[model samples]
Target: MNPRLPEFQTATATDEQKTILNEILSGPRGNLNGPFLGWIFSPQLAQHAQRLGAFCRYQTGLPLRLSELAILVTAARWRAQAEWHIHYPIAMQAGLPADIAEAIRVGAEPTFAEQDEALIYAFATELYETKRVSDATYQQAVGRFGHTVVVNLVGLLGYYALVAMTLNVFDMRADGQNSLPFAE
Candidate 1:
């Protein structure tokens, strides 16, 4: 798919844009791609989003594995090819089961071996599919991970959903690969 926006170039960037790009480059992400490329159109928004995303992806209360699982679920729910491609390997590196990530990529319900993974999958899937999570699922998440983690989980979901929407709206392709595993 062709991108609706042009790629950001540092050579032509204004001072403010250069600052924002510098901030992103210095962060843990090191370099920008995917949604960040689109975000450069609004430097301030990109700055704030980068901070929030850093927290969600790195500092959230949930383990990296569970957080990546939630992200995978969000990517699958939105069929965000860029997101899936970017995070699939990270999810695997974080120790998420390969079969589970592949299942989510293919739009199948993954059978999770870990209870925490199962809970996160259920929570994210229920929210994405129905726009609301059942009380039982909510309570299970809260009981297991506490309210702070639950709040972070919801924030993570909403944040990634926004990223997915941006990637889809602008037709961002991951690493020049245009195919998505799941059907629209």
Candidate 2:
């Protein structure tokens, strides 16, 4: 687990919130201080992470729905409150149902309208349960999403899994200033 803040904590951000602040203001966020933060602070993880963002955003073309689904599952599987807390609203903004996001926060089976969401949840569950997905599930995903999306979905799971673990390992918490799922 790495230290939460990089030395220059924001004026409004508390030390408690610094855990979450590290993620929001620095590291990945725009208001960065140090040369590297979050993934950048970790050179080894950065190589894989940079490629992962590209893979999820470009290679997959998964859109926000499936991407959010992949992220939420990774958060829940790892009990990562911070990741779940932030992505909860982002997922809804991406068009996922509020009910589904809430269910995911507390570790419940999520209902879905998008076929890709269901498939992603299934894949995440399978991976968490057995450490590997079955051939039938893989085939179904490939058939439904095509090979490129399937590949990126896998990447999404892996990338978000890294995020969840990183947050958890560092005891990261949410910045409380964030709004709820449907907040305007």
Model 1 residue 145 CA deviation (Å) reads 0.6
Error of 1 at 48 (Å): 1.2
lDDT by residue (1-184, candidate 2, tens digit) is 2357464434754454454434434433444321224555454455455546545644577777778777888777777666777777778888888888778777778887877778888987898889999999999888887888777787878777777676656555566623322221
Backbone clashes in model 2, listed as residue pairs: none
lDDT for position 27 in model 1: 90
Q: For model 1, how does the per-residue alpha-carbon lDDT over 18-68 read when each residue is reduced to its tens digit?
A: 888888889998978768888889988888888899889887799999999
Q: In terms of TM-score, how similar is model 2 to the real structure? A: 0.72
The TM-score values for the models, in the order shown, are: 0.94, 0.72
Model 2 per-residue lDDT at 13: 46
Give lDDT for model 1.
Answer: 0.88
Highest TM-score scorer: 1
The alpha-carbon lDDT assigned to residue 48 of candidate 2 equals: 55
